[model samples]
Target: MFLRTVTTAATLLAMGVTASLAQDPIEERQQIMKDNGQAMRVLVPMARGQADYDAEAALAAFVSIRDDAARFGELFPEGTETGGDTRAKPEIWTDREGFDAAVAAFVEDAEAAVAAAPADLDAFRPVFGAMAENCGDCHEVYQVPEN
Candidate 1:
């Protein structure tokens, strides 16, 4: 009986740990965006001529954004629109087709940037600008203002 009780306790503990690790969609997407923001930090200074452009670093940043964009859409599941301090606007669900298109554009632009593999600041600007525009467009329509 003691052995069986210990086994049950261990199983319950394991389940609790699993539940905690499984972040809600809002938290997951926020983390992904935070990661993308970090990647942008790596690229922005180089684009601005404040930091030396490194092909490897630029490629890695582009790849990160591409990867995030690929998975970002799944985080907006039906019930997640209004929780966990989400900045997502209702348009994200109401205008689902448009939202999906924006995500696709971001992914496409990031993939193109990665494929281009910009070797210098001159080469990096256009690709980065295009990807940045996609971000701006989506945020303008789909995100709530901080103020």
Candidate 2:
């Protein structure tokens, strides 16, 4: 139906409909990481993000990260775009299944990290560190730090 109308096709293409379907999962994963990273960076700096500072808002942020981290696993579907500038190393593509398992681990750990966050600064520190460690672990094995 969409292709039947030349005008519609043009509109869809302009709206970013042409190439995404053809891209592999890795590409999607990398884009997701970059996007999520942007969001995390922004939220982490806010005083309301810390439990000691604003327990409610900080918990909200933690919950968001906790949930998003799990969903993020879908973005890195192995060999889809691992060779690109993504922090993911090429080895990830070589062992696609393992890569996915790693993502699962991160998701689980991230949730724990978020859950561990307490309303105190001291408590929030370790919880947040856990979250960062999950990310760092992946980067160490499958990703390259951005220059």
Off by over 4 Å in 2: 1-27, 42-52, 82-85
| Best TM-score among the predictions, by candidate number | 1
Task: Report the lDDT of model 2 for residue 107.
Answer: 78
Model 1: per-residue lDDT, tens digit, 70-121?
8789889899989799999999999999999999999999999999999888
Put down candidate 2 lDDT per residue, 16-129, tens digits, no spaces: 522362365555555456544643553466534532254444555566456556666566553455355566677677777777777787777667756776676666666666
- Residue 104, candidate 2: Cα error in Å is 2.4
TM-score of each: 0.83, 0.60
- In candidate 1, which residue pairs get closer than 3 Å at backbone N, Cα or C atoms, i.e. clash? none
